[model samples]
Target: MYVIIVYDIKVERVNKVKSFLRQHLFWIQNSVFEGEVSRSEFQKIKNGLLDIIDEEEDSIIIYPFEFFSEVERTVLGVEKSPIDEIL
Candidate 1:
C-alpha cells in the first residue's frame, strides 16, 4: 500500500524520528514522509515509531492509499512532482 506518514514531535527528538522514518519512507517535506510499504513493513514501522515517540507529546498520522490515481492534489510554491517510482 502507499502511505504518507506525518509526525509532530518534541524538538529534542524530531531528528531521531525523521531518521527512523527515512528508513521506511521518503522524506517529502519537513516531518512529512510518503512511500509504498507492504502491510508487514507498515506494521514494523508503526512499532518502531511507538518505541520512539512520547505519548504525551508526540503524534504520528498514517494515511494509506488504496490507489494512487484516486488522489487529487494541488501545489503552489516549490511544487514537487509526484515520484515516478510511486506510480
Candidate 2:
C-alpha cells in the first residue's frame, strides 16, 4: 500500500515526528510525506505516530491507496521537494 501523511502538530514535537517518519517515508514537502510500505509497516506507523503526537493538540491525516497511479496532481509553481514526483 501507498500512504501520504500530512500532519499539523505542535512546534515542540515537530522534529520528533519528522525524524520518525523520515525512517519510513519520502519527505515531499513540509509536513507532508508519501511512500509505499507493507501492511505491517503501516500499522507500526499508525502506532508510532500515536505515541508521538498529543491527541488534544495535534492532528495527522493519512491517505492510503492501493496504487499511487490513482492520484491526479497538478503543480502550479516552483517545487520544493527533493524528488520531482513519485509514480
Candidate 3:
C-alpha cells in the first residue's frame, strides 16, 4: 500500500522534517511524502515527525494506501513540494 503524508508545518521546521523523511522514505512528492513501508517503518516515520513538530503550531496528515493521483490532487493548494519521485 502507498501513503500520502501531508503536513502544514511552520517554515522554520519544514527542512528538518524533510531531511528526516529524505533519509527514510522513497518517492517523496510535495509535502505529501510517498512510500511503501512496513508498519514498523510507518511508526518510525510518525515518531520522527512528532519529535520535530510543535504540535500546536505544526500539523501533519499521514494517509496510507492512497492512490498517487488522489494524493497529488489533494495537495493542489498546499504549495510546498520538496519531494517528487516515483515509488
Candidate 4:
C-alpha cells in the first residue's frame, strides 16, 4: 500500500520521529512522508512510532491507499518524487 505519514512532534523529540519514519518512507516536506510499504512493514512502523511518541504532546497522521495511482498529487514548486519502490 501507498502511505502518506505526517507528524507534529515536540521539538525535543522531533528528530527521533523524523529519523524513524525516514527508514520506512520518503521525506517529501517538513513533516510529510510518502511511499509504499507492506502490511507488516506498516505495522512495524506504527509500533515503532508508538514507542517513540508522546501521545499527549505529539500527533501523527497516516493516510493509506490501495494503489499509488489512486492518489492525485500536485506540486507547484520543487518536485520531490516519491520512492518508486521499497527495497
Which model scores highest in lDDT?
2
Clashing pairs in 2: none
- The global Cα lDDT (0 to 1) of model 2 is 0.90
Candidate 1's displacement at residue 77, Å, is 1.1
Better of 2 and 4 by lDDT: 2
Q: Pick the candidate with the highest TM-score.
A: 2
Q: Candidate 1, after superposition: displacement of residue 22 in Å?
A: 0.7
lDDT of 2 by residue, 21-68 (tens): 999999988999988899999999999999999999999999999887
Report every candidate's CA lDDT: 0.83, 0.90, 0.73, 0.87
**Positional deviation of residue 76's Cα in model 3 after best superposition, in angstroms:** 9.0
Candidate 4 residue lDDT tens string, 1-87:
989999999999999998999898888888999888899999999999999999999999999998898888777877665444432
lDDT of 4 at 37: 89
Ranking by TM-score: 2, 4, 1, 3
lDDT of model 1, residue 72: 62
Choose 2 or 4, whichever is better by TM-score: 2
Candidate 3 lDDT, 1-87, residue by residue in tens: 557678878999999988888776653455756666777888898898999999999999888863445554444555454444343
Pairwise TM-score winner, candidates 2 and 3: 2
Q: What is the lDDT of residue 78 in candidate 4?
A: 72
Clashing pairs in 3: 28-83, 29-83, 30-81
| lDDT of each residue in 1-72, candidate 1, tens digit only | 888888899999898899999898887777888887888998999999999999899999989987666556
